[model samples]
Target: MRPNYLVIILLIFYSCNKIETRDEVYPTKLYEKAKYFQNENISDSAFYYFNLAKNDYVKINDSTGASKSLVNMAIIQCNNGDFYGSIETSLEADKLLRNESDSTVKSTLAANYNNMAISSSFLKNYEESVAYYKKTLQFSNDAENRYIYNNNIGDALILLGQYKEAKKYLELAIFTKDSLIYAKVLNNIARAKFLDDQNYNPLPELNKALIIRQNNKDIEGQNSSFSTLADYYLEKNAEKSLLYSYKLLETSEKIKKPEDQINALQRLIMLDKPNYLKYFKRLTAINDSTQTSRNKAKNQFAVIRYDVEQKDAENKNLKLRDAENEINIIYLSFGLGILIITLIIGHFWNEKRKKSIKIEKEKEKELEVKNTELRYSKKVHDKVANKVYHVMSELENTENMNKEVLLYKLDGIYQISRDISYDKNDVALEHNFSQHLSQMLKSYSSENIKVPIIGNEESLWEDVGDHSKVEVFYILQELMTNMKKHSKADKVLLDFSRENDLINIVYSDNGIGISEFSPKNGIQNTESRINSIGGTINFDTKTENGLKITLSFPAKN
Candidate 1:
């Protein structure tokens, strides 16, 4: 009796491992042909093909192909509202592909991480989404892929209520070379800005995103951009929101994406409940077709499973002795398989080394080009532009100088030279932080403007790059220009300090404070520019003196 029980247990275990299926020629034919399905509206068939491909790859021992198929299936699952299932499948693929050092494999791994993040987003697990997106950045080295991953990271952070961090990553992603990524990053940033209460209006960021999407002719991106802008203006400008929603509906129709069309129609319905019936009917038809197709595919899968089970039973009954003899042959085949795998591993290692060398050379070439551009710009500013300014200065200071005449002539020359040299090179300000502050103070030392400078010069320029120096210059220019024009302050003090990784800049004047002022056009422009550079600005209006502005930024490299 005990021996019989042990045999029964073994049989149950083998049965559990077996794939149950139906016994019918039509079902088998359908199962095989299902692998070729690729209909946009038929999410079920697409999902079925994805699973078939994954199983096919596993049978062939192709890890990379299996991972790809799994990712594709997860994408469809995400679209069909099975977000948790999608996340699980993506995680399994990620684990299998992690050991692969191939860039193409790594790219797929990054994509899996991105899909997992999207699934997490559907579940409203913002923190987990952010964590997975961060993982994507680690695996993705391709510039275009990195750009999208960075933007997704920003979007996830924004959803987590980390506005400042979201903006920082979004700026980096937008600064990337890919236009599609740039446009998408801009849209995400706009959403973040809209969420931040500090921003009175986030229309500018939305407009910037719209312009970029339109310029790149990204229809999907454009659809998103228009929808966002429409929602944004819905509260403040109802007419504008309605107009953009209608425009988005037209674009969605042109693109022929049913889901997007459904979204646009829904948004239009919200704006105009009376006219929405036209779009609503179309949306319902598409949605119904999608659900029907998915149901049919699910039913077919059940049929295939039943047929496969019957075939396994018949094959097992007819080949019991043959399978026992083949067991020894399987052991022999496994031994040779291990040896072949070892050789393949060795080949892959050498190939990876060669690719790394090529990548290094390309990076070096890019860095060289950037350095050459900076050097050329420095030469033009230091030699050509500076000399012209000096000659004009001497002419103005001469004994019989015509002040008005010299001033007008110098202004034209300055404008013309600036235009000519603008593309040649960027102007580098004084590298010493203290000297830069002093120059700013001197520039505002006229009868109407008084700015006292305070900062140290020790080692400020030692490790800093031209990028940081230029940012400081632009900040100073904007601040002083604001003070001179609007502050009405007769006295101003500028303070600067560097502590650890942070740089602090304080500008205060004895003029009219910010309470007496609204967001000046200049202030708005400055705010946008400063945000683009990943810096924060706080306006202290409680001061009885002039407006006090505090600027903090990460030290430039």
Candidate 2:
């Protein structure tokens, strides 16, 4: 007969209700697979699948499914001899259960608590086990469950030396018509009566239960009956006690329960002195190995749970990163769409204004030919032409142009064209030059492309002249646009460094190199602007892997 510690493990699985899964695959399939393995006695595989099912249930917000899976996992742990781990796992299931719930959930909650009680009993925490059995009864609505919990509570109370209270619950348990359950309770009642009052004769009830257990072929029940009878006869009849003790040890070994075998050996060592040394050695051996088995069980279960937790955390982190990346892509695309629309409208409006000015000038030339020609030429060059050409050039160069900047430039041109004599030379000085440079390079990034910037801190640009900053800004801007348009590149990197009074930038892209480099703007604009700021630009067009352009310039005048 297995120890009563194994009794609760049986109690739970027999009575617990499985959560009904109506065709949904994810959690339901996992639950089914776990059940198949559990029924097949593949405990490790069962625990693994049940844990997976619990995680899946949590993801879908099915509290009932998660609780059921946890309960089953706890039972598996109990069966595997990991009593502490079993109690911990059962508590996890309890957290998922509600205090007041539907009948099915109530039944689940009862079974979960019952598992805790059984595992606690095995660990010799009888007070805690009694408390847990009472909790199990609290959720139980079924009369059969009431009987079961009563018997369990009685068993634990007997362990605590409360024989009178143990008999009270055992009497309630004996009211059941179940012959097997009746036999179990009858033995407990007999043990309690004899324990509480040494004068009380329990042989009749004990013998009757033993007969019923034998008739039913209840091996665990017979194991209990043998133990109870042997203890009862130990003080009164030495010969009968020795006979029952031998039977207990034989039956315990047949069932292969180390705890029961230990109990039986203990009785024999006390009763039969001839083989005391032999029985003592076997008892010691089993005791040592039992603890080893328990520790091994605890470690194996702990490792399995720990590994699953780590994998779940990794999966969640990966999902969170994916979600964030998707959101960024959406924002970038939306901003790009708005920018393109603004540029299109701005371009058409500017073209219309320039056309209107030329027509007016032509009409005036017919009336005051010489005067209008001179006035028209001066006004168009000074106000209408330069400011409009500036706006158009800025529009052409900047793709992700800021709305406020575009609006400011257009308003400047509008006012300048109206005054025709306000020649305000805009230097385009920016206080936060480093930030602007960083944003410009990063704006080119897409889902398929990565733009990583390095060492472009504000401190690096501190001593740089405004003319140099502005020229470098546009120079870098041109390179980015050029790469996007023709490089077919997937990666772009800009590494910046400084040496005392000079700032150096090396721009690279993993794209088809300068063999396909078609330089537009015959003016050599990049070279001219670099030289104006005491800067030199070098292009390595020989590499096949990508483009590497190095620009070195004095940080200050």
Candidate 3:
């Protein structure tokens, strides 16, 4: 066993959480005094001081302190026999401590759950006891806590008549270094085994555990052993069972354990038929007293928390009203200042601003008309004029090209010109773009003009955006239109290559390079496209053989 294992065992099994209190603070002082009363076994005074401390913690918005105080009050409530009230108080503490994971907060939470589990066990809510015990294990840092919690869960399961499942946990709980723990496990294990199979012998284990508890003078252990043994021999040896019952009653009364007293009286009522009525009367009196005490304890705990809640609710209402009044005053002042500013600004500059806006609108209207005319002119020349010239070259080149193919091309050109004003692009130029581009460049080829395109692989179009591809298509189409009309170039070469995300195009011809280097509207339209894609264009008309136009742009939009 590790050094701190005992400390952890004490913390878990005995619920010994170290109270941290600051003497300088009144709330902490109250908490310290509450701890003193709690240690002295003055529960009502402890509950009073803890309630005061909780309200103080709430006033300061110290949720951790408030939750810790509540956990302490809940334990006191459970010890006072208010099981249901303890469960409610522990749940309230858990709400305050939710989403907190620091070590101290976790420790407080573990204590909170352990209290609930104990209260649940007392309430005969074995299922709830098992559930809360498992939840307690989840927060406990000590691995050795498994022995304690697993045994508790097993005990609950035994009462639930889940004997087979009960033994599984009890088997793991035989950590023998702790004698009381081992004896507790041994008693429960024998009970579970005997309950599971009537023919199974439990006396050896049962007597062994009873002897260990007797030697240790463990009052709770002795009570458990006394009850188990009396029940086991109730039919077999009534005299022996009655002896354990009298011992149980004597010990229970000496220790002020009313629950154990009730159990012992019931056994005596059944085994001692001659004195049955006397034991039954005693049983009735003790039962009434225990019930009255439990009820009083429950009411006391509830009323304390309820009073705090009522005061806190009233405080919230008062704060909300004060905040509302301050907000209304601020809003009134802000409204008046905004109204004055609005009137002054409206009187001084409203007409001048209106006049300025009208002049700007008129200028924008004029520029929009000019831009519209320029776009229309460019689209018509690019989509109509260039397309018609390319068709003319196709007709002149093909010996017997069918009229249907010719009509389709002309109809496509017609639709483009018709929708040119509304259309932002020539739809889907990126579909099989490489093959389409190759076909378009080579279409301008005739017997005299050998236009060979290089590096027109399909993969070059991989990362290129649709809009950029459309612009590049238009630029190339405009260049081809000019080459066919004016450049008078033969044996034109179009080279394409890619560097990372950039596309590079090189165009050259063997004949008739431009001398003056002047570009018309079609050439200017190509220049605009190059600039639009944020690319560079270089026209080397002074090249030895022909005009060399080089361009580079981003492959993606």
Candidate 4:
């Protein structure tokens, strides 16, 4: 009886305190205020306060609050045409939340990549956009994020002229559980296939997207699908297209997406045919702007390629001139040697003819001296040259020796055998050299290498002597074998022809090429083999194709 009023007073005070506690615990006043500015499309104030609240949440270590703020800021940036800037902020948020092991960070990354892809599409950098969207697909772990990223990739691929690949990605997107994302992917696929002359229409996909948006009460998505579909049908059904376009225009105006409104207005002009001159002017203006931008980019890429080609051509010309000078020096040396030998022979012949009566005793002395020198020269050539050749061939095949090592060996061999020659009087060098070359090619081909020898039956050597045939065959064999082992070719054709006194052997193949012809064993051997007969070899590597070997020989009487 003494405490009844006191207990009643205490109970009232406790109830009021509990209400205050609840209010302090859930203080959504700032969030509500920010949402108002966002809904009003006032981006400047919305971004400022969102940052303020996001910083406060970070100070309090509130990850959920921080994430919401970041998402809202990103959406605002996307609406304001600062797409790349938005992606930068989104990635920062993603990194923070990923360190916290948040699952939603993956979805956020997918969203950022998708936004980047859309911006890049507007820029018409399809390759770069497709690459970004692929990263989105890789990071999107959940079904919904996967569906969105897949659609993003599909759209980029379509713009890149990769319609076949786009179709597969789009179909996979549509099969996902997120009906809204699935519908968007389907629309992209259908439009892409239609543009590519494939058997698919976008109307069904657009309608499906509309259905999902309507059911979910997603007005923005509904407006986008309607606008796209109406623009699509504008060509075939003018009245229906106009009706849909009007609906989209009204919805877009309410949502305050000015770009979508502009698009809808353009479509209306197309379908209704009202203000025809104005529509034509707008389209012309857009086209001119687009073409100007495209020309700038195309010119930039072309300039890079042109500069590279110019440098390459300049280098090649210098090399060719040096090679020509070397060849001239070699020819001059051979001419001088031949002239000296000829004069000596003529002098001796004249002396012998003039002294024929006295030379009977002198002839015996001359014969013995000539025989001794010939025997000594044969012994040196057979033993020293054969042993050197065997050692060089062994070094050439070893993996330990690099290209420079092999080149050094070939140069050494050239210096050592500088005086060797295939003269007409060498009977061993005279034979069916074309047949011998074909047999070598056949052996290479039997080892599962693609080596084809053509023009062997057609004889360019019909009138040429044995020395010429031997030199030509040796050079041809070396060139063909080099092409087979190094060129990685599937087919090789060798053409031999003779025009008057000059004989030509042309060897070409469809394989990887030598850019400007780096000197290899095959090349050195062929060059040495040709030089032995006083012939020349010229070869070139065509860009991205294969090697072309040309051999020229002077026919003897």
The models' CA-based lDDT, in order, is 0.69, 0.82, 0.85, 0.65
Using alpha carbons, what is the TM-score of model 1? 0.45
Question: Model 3: per-residue lDDT, tens digit, 1-557?
Answer: 23235334443443222223323347998999999999999998899889889888987888988999999999999999988778888999999997557888888888898899999999898888899888888888875676888899899999999999999999989865798899999999999999999999999999999899999999889999999989988888999999999999999999999999999999999889999999999999999999999888887777776786788789779856865665555446556665666677676678888899999999999999998898789788877888888888888878898999999999989888878878765653735888888778887888888888899898898978777787788888877777887777778889999966889999888768877688878788888888888898889977667688998999876
Error of 2 at 425 (Å): 70
lDDT by residue (1-557, candidate 4, tens digit) is: 22334444554575566557742323245556678898997766676566656655665677666666666676666555555555565665655555434656666556656666665665677887887788777667777777777787788787788888888888778778766676677668777777677455666767777888889887788886786678676676788888887888788778866566667767867676767577557556655654564455344323433554576578669857865665555446555655666677778878877788577768878988886665445433432443354445456545586778667766755654553443223322434556655765565453335666666663656777665665565455556546544778777777777755787777777788877767854466567667767788887766578778788878773
lDDT of 1 at 349: 74
RMSD in angstroms, all models?
A: 25.4, 30.1, 30.1, 30.2
lDDT-based ranking:
3, 2, 1, 4
Residue-wise C-alpha lDDT for candidate 1, range 403-519, written one tens digit per residue: 796777577556646655455433434355557547645755765455667774655444555566565565566666666656678888878787556777888888877764467
Q: Work out candidate 4's RMSD over C-alphas.
A: 30.2
What value of lDDT does candidate 1 attain over all alpha carbons?
0.69
Residue clash pairs of candidate 2:
none
Tens-place lDDT digits, model 2, residues 75-148: 99999899989999999998888746688789899899899999999999999999999989989888877988
For all predicted structures, in order, the TM-scores are 0.45, 0.55, 0.52, 0.38
Cα shift from native, residue 458, model 1 (Å): 82
